[model samples]
Target chain A: MIEIKHLKKSFGSHHVLRDVNLKIEDGKITSILGGSGSGKSTLIKCMMRLLDSDGGEILVNGKDITKVTNPFRLAAVRRHFGYLFQEGALFDSMTVGENVAFGLSYLTDIPKEKYPAVIKEKLAMVGLKEEVAKLNPSELSGGMRKRVSLARVLAISPKCILYDEPTTGLDPIMSDIISDLILEMKKKIGITSVVITHDMHSAFKISDYIAFLYEGEIMLYGTPEEFRKTDNPYVRQFVDGSSHGPIQMKLMRE
Target chain B: MFTAIGKVMMNWLDQTGGAADMVRSAGFWLARSRFEFKQFVLQSITIGVDSFGVTALTSLFTGMVLALQAGNTINNIFGDPIFVGTIVSFSLIRELGPVLTGVVVAGRAGAAVTAHIGTMAVTEQLDALYTLGTNPTQYLVIPRMGAFLLTMPVLTVFSNIFGVIGGYLVAVYALGVPGEVYLSDITTFMGAKDFMHGFIKAFIFAFMIATVCCYKGVSTRGGAEGVGKSTTGAVVTCIVLILVLDYFLTAILAAFGI
Candidate 1:
């Protein structure tokens, strides 16, 4: 389990995350739902220590990871969580099989001889054929790339998986397929998941608990049912997808 | 004006600091022996072998031109193209060979390194490496630095040899300076110290190119545009530094009687 207290992050004067406090329960899907540029990704990056928080306590295993400055210690902590980038972020120079085996070589004590079998198993887990591994990431479709990314993440067998906009840039069918895959991973492996997404339909379907982040703070934190029934005007505006609300988008004028 | 100047100074300090930090991190990983040998070999091919053809061509033409010009100037003064080979050979071995090779590699291979790594940066591939419990410095920068440092001196030696041959061809065939005279001039005038002077410069330039390019790449922002800017900046910075540092290095080496 991970708990964040009064997390604060800023880019110069413009604060991206301000006083964010939440708890991510173990072995469950927790979706951070927010509008674009609403600091959803920032919050998780801070959790991962990819971005340093201005002030916060991210308690994991009864230790404040925010204070962990040693690189190896940080890496040991990072090994516990897998991050799925928004665009898959697979190595373009590597074959899909090599990409899947990359993390295994680093993060685990898995024998070199077993890498092929592990690659096949992880690919199978993500519903990709063994032959698909020989191909480059560029040849894979958008949905396939995401699946490959997930397979690569799963190859490391992380305790928790962080998905960043997993369903973005996919058609409805493919989006639903990714959503189902997330659910399946939860059911089969019981791995903790923290998905950052603006896709309401997918978030509503997969999230066991949802946190509505508005203007860099969690305006609402509850179950899907609770989110649907919430009376907070900000949460209501975001949930209903209504344009006429207090949640106004800042636009740059040319 | 003051604000703009302050901003520029800050930017320079920031980049220098970033490059220093990267060098320290890469050094830490290297001390732990975390880098792979296979990666070093692959990067050697990319940084050394891939750029060799262009380096050879550039040095060849430079040698030919140096021979021809020296022959013309000597002929004008003494009514014979005497000492043309000595001039060509000495200049090529002591200064031009290493400096020209450094420039070629910096423009060709160094830009490529920045572009490849910069593309990865914008694509979040660096972030992905971190998530995979791998340091980008260990996986990417170390091998490239190893390849550059190992290959630069070797390439400089080859560049010098090829340049001498070009000078020989031009001095003998074009300028009617006898082959024996050209060969004897090189053998008599040049020594190990002259070669060492250039080799040391090549080694230093190798470090500069690798560090600057990798620094620009890892610190790249924005997107494709950012990659372009970083690549350009890396090559430009490398070429300028190589030329600027060559004078100081020569003075230092000369003072040490290298």
Candidate 2:
């Protein structure tokens, strides 16, 4: 389980995360749903230790990563996470196969000779063909890039995977395929996941628990049914995508 | 006015402090990652061998121009161009070869490193590497730094040889000086220490360019615009520093009686 308590982050005069708190259970998907500028992505980045929180306790399996100073120890803590970026973020200089093989070659004790087999296996898991391995990331389409990014993350075999807007830009069909793959990851591998997305349908389909992030805080936290039943103006505004609700359009413009 | 000055000061301090931290981390990782021999070799070839054309061209022109002007001036006064080879070899081996080569690298390779690293930073590939338990300073910066340090001197040597050849062509054929006189004068006036002087300067310039460019690159923010800014910023900063450092290095070498 991961516990984020009193997490606060600010940029100059703008406070991005304000007294935010969350509890993410293991072996299931917990989706943090929020509109743009709602700090959902910031919350996950802070949890991943990519951005430092001005004030917070981020406990990963009971150890506070914020306080860890040693490079080796901090890296060891970070190794537990596999973060998939919003834009796939594959290394542009390397080919598709080399991208997935990078972590395997660098981080693991796996033999150098077995890297090709391992790369092939991970790409196949992401439904990527072996022929695409030779092509550069720039040559791939958006959906294929995301799948290759997923393959790269899975190469590390991290304890938990963090997805940031996994289905943001894809078509409905492609999004559903990604959602199915995410669900398969949870059901088949039984690994923990924290998905950050604003897509209500995808969140409802894949998440065991959904947390609504608003103004840098969790406005509501519960199962899908509980979320649907909530009449809170903030929650309603987001769930229904209503412009008439309490969430002003200007503030959500960020 | 005070606020603007304070902001500038703070920005300078912040960047300087960040550079120091990267240097520290790079030192630590470089010691542990001696096994990245393959990466070092690849980067060396890219930074040095692939950069042959531009550096060679710059050195060639500078040498040719130097010989041409010197030959004309000496011929006007003495009715014969004399000491053209001595002047070309001395000036090149002492200053132009290393300095011009350093400037070319700062403009070309330094910007490339910043663009490469800055794009990775903006794209969150750096975060991906971190999440995989790989220190980017070790995986990225160390190999590049190692390559630059290993190859800058070699590039300097290539510049020196090409520069002399260019000067020889100008002095003998273009200026109508005897080929034997020009060749013998180069052997006569230039010392081993003169070549070594520029060679040592190449190493220092390489270290500075690598550190400055990589620091700016890794600390890049914003996005595509930020990477463009970093590439420009790195090249400008590296060139200015290379020039300033050239003066200091010359002074120090002179003081050492080299």
Mind giving the per-residue lDDT tens digits that candidate 2 earns over B1-258? 999999999988998899888989998887765457777888888888667889899888888998999999999999899999999888888888878888888787788889999999998888877876686798788888888888888888888888888998999889998889988989998888898898889888888888988999999999999999989988888888888988999999999987
Model 1 misplaced stretches (Cα beyond 4 Å): A249-254
Displacement of residue A209 (Cα, Å) in model 2 is: 0.4
Worst 10 residues of 2 chain B by lDDT: B30-39
Residues A87-205, model 2: lDDT tens digits: 99898988988898988866799998998888899989889888888999999888898899999999899889999999999998889888888888888888789999988889889
Task: DockQ for every model, please.
Answer: 0.92, 0.73
lDDT of each structure? 0.92, 0.87
Q: Candidate 2 has which clashing residue pairs, if any?
A: none
lDDT of 1 at B228: 99
Please, what are the lDDT tens digits per residue for candidate 1 over residues A61-165?
778899989888999889888999999999999999999999988889999999999999999999999999999999999999999999999999999899999
**Runs off by more than 4 Å, candidate 2:** A249-254, B1-9
Q: Compute the lDDT of residue B32 as modeled in candidate 2.
A: 65
Error of 2 at A24 (Å): 1.2
